[model samples]
Target: MRTSGRRIVFLVGLQGVAWLLPAGTIIQQEEREPGTSKVKAQATISIDAGKLRMEQEKPGEGKSVMIFDQSKQVVWMIEPAKNSYMELTAAQVQQMGGQMQQAMKQMEAELANMPPEQRKMVEQMMKQRMPAPQAEKEVTVREKGQGEKVGPYTCIHYEVLTSGKLTREVWTAPMDQTHLGGAEFKTFQALGEFFGKLSGQAPKGTWELSGMNQMQGFPVRVLEYEGPRATSEWMLVKAEQRSLDASLFTLPAGLKKSSMEGMSRE
Candidate 1:
């Protein structure tokens, strides 16, 4: 789950073209729970044109790796401990979206039969997970006319609003500074769209969601809120541009790929 620190040194040879070679970028991020100063998880993200890999480690959850290959239009979720991987295609994600919608309907039906007090409690809890499907609302982003120095980069601050309520705040650095090109940014957006559909969750102004399109840069720090309470914070820790091998995006030979059905059964 780690990106190699090996650097591809540039040589000013006769052609002087070695310095022009494309380089992959690596970013480190730390996550914290709401109202807590202690970090709860850490993630390393590697970005190359048309591809991305993220490795996240959280307390008690071990490490998980996710790779998105734009060329194949598939995402691979790898479990190193099991030496296995799962591929999620657009069709599979769409099918899962339908399944989630059906489950939401079932939950709503059951909620109607619960005691009024219990229903209120449950509904309050569900707000943080999934918004009610019927409550359609557009997410909005606004520039706050402020900036922050996060890590080595200076970032513009912005706010995300859902139905006129503050839902998230973000600080972003320009794509040039983040070493993100058009293809890489597009792939990143696609990942957001896929996860949004798979989870049946409304967009909350993240870099991967609709609102981020208005933000004009890559997110460096993001703070998510539930009503008036800060729920989570993700801040960039480091970014490095270096050469990455194509094999980094490929699955290991001889490992079995698990199906969605097999995953659910487990």
Candidate 2:
């Protein structure tokens, strides 16, 4: 229960901001996380001044979409497989996150009052039930040098070290060159600031890209490896500026719109 609650808080905060830009479509190549598979997935991220959407491409799979509307301060997770969309407001998300944190604090208080052995058993049971966490990764990023083409443009290279071991190389080109600048960039910044407060922790890449405001450019390619094995890579395949139809920012017809608050109340 605690884990799921934490996940909700994290997801609500992250989804509200992470993927965004101007009126354009960005095609990205996403490989499964390390140890999963060699197969890759294509994702289309579309953004306009007022909204953002991400759709993963897969054969024989029903359409799934995550849409965020900045003006409304809401997010919609659409599942065509189920013919439904789940929505959450910024206020509701923050309130739910606060509830989760308070519940955890109360749990800690109860744990403190319990006998040592009982507390240990409870923790052990929790560990056994939950999935193992990913390797503890402390990411340190620095601009190192230059690199070859990333997508359509030449880029500068940056290295990512996880727990002091170099594990990733990133290539970046100018943000404007990606066709996402001015108003859209400002929208992302606003979302970042808004969510950073609710999440209590800044997103990982957010910290790594801190000074990019003055430096320019965003990561266009990221190659991640584990030792000699190539774990994963996500690269920007295409980007262009255009006016996205407003309908694309909303749920499709015949699908029901639902809210987290209503479900929780029920």
What RMSD, rounded to one decimal, does every model reach? 7.2, 15.3
lDDT of 1: 0.76
Position 234, candidate 2: lDDT: 68
Best by TM-score: 1
Candidates in order, TM-scores: namely 0.79, 0.64
Q: Write one digit per residue (lDDT tens) for candidate 1, span 104-199.
A: 889899999999999999999987667543226678899986567877778898999988889888888988888777877887787776666654
Q: What is the lDDT of residue 119 in candidate 2?
A: 99
Pairs in steric clash, model 1: none
Off by over 4 Å in 2: 1-28, 32-38, 59-61, 110-139, 160-169, 190-215, 223-230, 259-266
